[model samples]
Target: MASLVLTDGSQLTSDSQHLGMYSSPTASLVLTDSSQLTSDSQHLGMYSSPVASLVLTDGSQLTSDSQHLGIYSSPVASLVLTDISQLTYDSQHLADWCPLGKDTYFRKFEIYSMAWQNEINLDNVVLAAASYGGPVAVVRDRKRFIKVQTTGKPVISIYTASGRQMSSIVWTGGQIIHLGWSSTEDLLCVQNDGCVLAYDMFGTYLHTFGMGQEAKDTNIIEAKIFASVNGTGVVVLTSSYRFFLVNNVKEPKVRQLAEVAGLTVPPSSWCVISEDRHTRVLMARGSDLYLLKHSEQHAFPVGLDLRENTKSVVEMAVSHNNRHVALFTDLGHLWIGSADMRKKYCEFDTKCPSRPRQLVWCGTEAVVGHWDTVLLVVNRQGEFINYSYDSPVHLLPEMDGVRVLSAFTHEMIQKVPLVVQQIFRINSTEPGSYLLEASKQFQKRSHRSDEYIRLVKDQLNVAVRQCIDAAGYEFDPSNQMMLIRAAQFGKSFVPDIDSEPYVKMCRTLRVLNAGNNHTENLTCGAWCGLVKFGNFWYN
Candidate 1:
C-alpha cells in the first residue's frame, strides 16, 4: 500500500499491489516512504507521465520503498522541490535599540510578516508605500526578466503594511516609470510619456493628468512625489534636462520650473523641498548645486564650500520636516546640513564609492542609506550604525521614521522616544523604573513594593508622568499595560495629581493599538479625517 499527501492536507491511499499516480500541469503531489517499493518488472510503484508537474514544498518527504523501482518520472514530467528556511518568531525580536548620540536612541522592530513572500520578488518590482502606516503598492518592473506563466499585461497589486493583499488590477496603461502614494492615499502611476494615473486604495481609477505638452514631447525620464504645502505634489525630469512641477495632484496645473542653466545633461541627483507654502527643486550638477524655484525664471546656485578634493554629489535626501538635507558625493562622503544651506552639521565618510540603492531620512534624526544588503544610519554629529540584511530591502520614509520592507517582513526604524528610554534603558535608577518595579512587586504582594515606592517618594508625580508617556510610545500591549499599571501605582502616592493626561493617554493607546493590529483603520486618509474631527470637537 502507498499514500500520497497533498499541500491542502488531503491524502490518497492505494490498496492495489502496484501504486501508480499521475498529476496534471496544475496539480501537486508528495510521496513518503521509509522502505523501498518493490514492484513487478511490468509495473511501477509510482509513475509521473508526460506534462505532469510535481512540487515538494517545505517539510515534505519523497522516498523509494524498493531498490527495484520506487518512483519514476517521464522526460516530459517536471519535479521540483523548494527548500526555504522557515523564519522563526524570535527573528522578529532580534532588532534592538542603538544609541544615536548622547541622549537619543534608535530602534528597528518588525511591524508585519509579509504576505507576498513566494508570490513576488521585491527586487523585480516597483514599490510605493503610503505614509501614516498606509497601504503598499507593487508593480513588476518591465525592464527586468521575471518568470511567469503568461506574457500578458503586468498586474498591479495593493497590500496593507502587514502584507495582506487588498486589491489587484491588470495594468492597461503605458510604460510605468514610477509608482508613488499621495498625501490623500491615492496611488499615483507615472508613465514615461508624462501622464500620471491616480487610483484609490481599492485600485479603482480616479483621474488622470499629464505633465505638459513639453514633457510629452521630451519624455519624462524620472519623477518624484513629495508633500507640498498645498497637497501631494509631483515633479518630473524630462529627458531634455528640463523639469515640470504640479503642486497638487487634485489640481494638476503643470508649471515649468526655471531650467538649470549651462546644463546639457541630466543632473546627477535632485530632490524637492516644500517649505513656507512653496515648493522648490534642488539639483546637483557635478560639484555645483542649483536651486530651481517655480517663481524664478532662472536657476541659482546654492554654495557648498567643499574641499578641493571633494567629488560630485551623487545623491541627496531631505528630512521629513523639510528642515534638513543630506548629500552623498562620489568621494564616499555624506554631508548633513540645514535645508537652506546656511548651517553645516557634519560630513562623514562611508568609504563606499558605489551609489546606494536608496538614501532617505529616518525621521528627522538620522540619514539612512541602503545598498543591496547593507543599511547605514548616520546621525547629524556623524555617528553611525550599520545593519545587514540577507535579502533586498526597500525604504519608505515616513513622518516619524522609515519603513523597511523585505520579502519576508515589514519593519520600522526610528528614534526611540525619550520617555521610553528613561524607563526601559538599562540604568542605575530612574524614578519611572522604580515605579515599574514597585508596581510589579505590588502585584506579587511583596514588601519590596513599599521600598521601591519610597525610593521615588519625592518624585512620584514625575514617575507617573514618565510611565504614562512611555506607555503611549510602546507598541506592545503587555508593555503598555505594565507601564500603565506603574503609572496607576505611582499616581496613588501623589497628592492632587491631575489625571487628564493619564486618562487621555489610555484612551489614545487603546485606539492606536487597535489600529496597529488592524492596519486598515489607521491610514493616511483616516488619520486626516480624525484630525479634522478633533479640530471640530475642540472648536
Candidate 2:
C-alpha cells in the first residue's frame, strides 16, 4: 500500500502495493497496476485489489475496471449521476414511459371559409331554411326562392354541414352582419344597422327591435355583436352604450339594462348570453369585462380590470358543464374562471398563435384557428395533442388518447423522482415498510397503462424480494405450502396463467399443483393459493 500527501494538504492512501504514480497541482493523480493515482484523496483500502483506484485533487476517488467506474468520492459532494437511466439496461418495466410519446389533451380543427361573395345556380340554391334541433338545419324550395330574390347576390344565407351555403334570402339590404339561432329552433336573430330582426324558424319576420329608440334618440354609435340563447331572448348592446334584452315569442319580454356612458364600443365588441339566459357577459374596447345577471338585471363586478391595455379578448366561451368559463386573450394566453364569474383559476402561455380568429371547445379539447398555417388543440392542462389538420378529420379520438397520456405526463412531472429516491435510499434493516410503500405506488401507477402496469409490477416484485432479503426472511416449503392461500389475498399484477411473469412469480412462491401435487404454473388452485399468500403479506 502507498500513501501520498498533496501540496494543497489533501491526501490519498491506497492498499496498492508499491504502485508507481505521479500527480499535478490541478489534474488527477496517475498510478500503475493499470490503476492511476495522484492525490492522497484516496483513503486506505480504496483499491479493490482486482483493480486500481483513481484519486482526484479534492480527495474524491474513482475505482476503475475494464468496463465500469465505481465512483466514490471522499467527503462526497452531492454526486450527480448523469443520465443514469441511459447507463442502466432498458428495463422492461420502465419502457412504459416513452420519452418521445405523443402528447395528450389537445385536438386541432380544420377551417374552411364559406364564400361570402359567390353566385350559386338557382337549380342548386334553396330558400326558407330552418334548423330543427342540434347543429343541423334545412333549406327548401329552390325555384320559388329564385323568383322572389335578385340573381347572384349574397343576402341572407344558412351554412350547410359541408360548410356550403344551403340557402339565401333575397333582400335590398347591403349585407347581413351577424346571425344567431335560438335553442328551440323557433327563432333566428339577424343584426343589421341599428335593428335586430327576428325571424320564425320558417323565415317569417316576427319582430324588429329598433336600438336607436331603445337608446333614447342617441346616435347609433356602434354595433356590438349579439348572442341569443336558443330558448332565451336576444341580448343586444349598442354603440350608444345602451343594452337591451328582448324575447320575441308569444310572451314578449323586454328589459333595458345598465348603460355605459361616454364609452364607445367598437363594432368588434360583443355580448353573449349564458346558456341558461340568466346571465350575460360583455367585452368592450378598453379590455373591460362586464357581467350582468339578467334575472335580476344586476351587474356583477368581475374585477378582471383588463381595460385600456390595448389587448383584445379574442375568444370567450362557457364550459360545457356550465360550471366554468374560459377566456382567451389575443396573446395566446388562456384564463379560466368560475362560471359564476367569482374566481379565476390559472393563466398561462400557449403555443397558439396570437390573434387567432376563433376558439372552439370541442368536448374534451380546445381548438384554435391560427390563420391558415396551423390549428392548435389544447387541453385544460395545456398539452398540444394534435395539429396541422388540412382535410376532413375526426379529432375526438385523437384527443381522448392524448388526454390519457397527459395524466401520465403530469405524474412524471410531479412524482417519479421522489419515488426513485424513496426506493433506493432505503436501509437494509426494514424491508417490509419500504415494500408496503412501493406496493401502494405500484398499484396506483398500474392503472396508467398496460405497459405501465407491467413495469410497476416488475419493480414491485423486485422490491418484495429485496425487502424479504433485508429482513433475513426466506420462503421455505412450509411457507410455500401456504403460498396458495396467501396469494388468494395477495396483491398481484398477474391475472393470466399463460403470462411468463405470472408463471415466474408463482414458481417463486413454490405453489404446488393441488390436483397433481407437483410444482407447476398457476392453475385455478394455484391462484387461490396465491391469493392467500397476498393476504399473508398484506396483513
Q: Which consecutive 10 residues in model 2 have the weakest lDDT in total? A: 404-413
TM-scores for candidates 1 onward, in order:
0.78, 0.42
lDDT of 1 by residue, 1-539 (tens): 12345222122334322223332233334433212333321232234333333443332234221111112232222334332222222011213777788977888887777767887688898899887678889888878886878888989999887787889878998889889998778999999999999999889999999999999998999999999878899999999999999999998999888988778988999999999888899999998999998989999899996656876899999998899999999888899999999899999899897898999998888999998999999999999998999999999887667889899988888887766666655432678867876786688687868977888899998899989877766666776788898899898887799999888878776766666664453432122223224211110
- The deviation in Å at residue 174 for candidate 1 is 1.4
**Candidate 2 lDDT score at position 83:** 30
Q: Number of the top candidate by lDDT?
A: 1
| CA displacement after TM-score superposition, residue 11 of candidate 2 (Å) | 50
Output the number of the TM-score-best candidate: 1
Backbone clash total for model 2 is 41
Model 2 C-alpha lDDT versus the unseen true structure: 0.37
Reference-based lDDT, each prediction:
0.75, 0.37
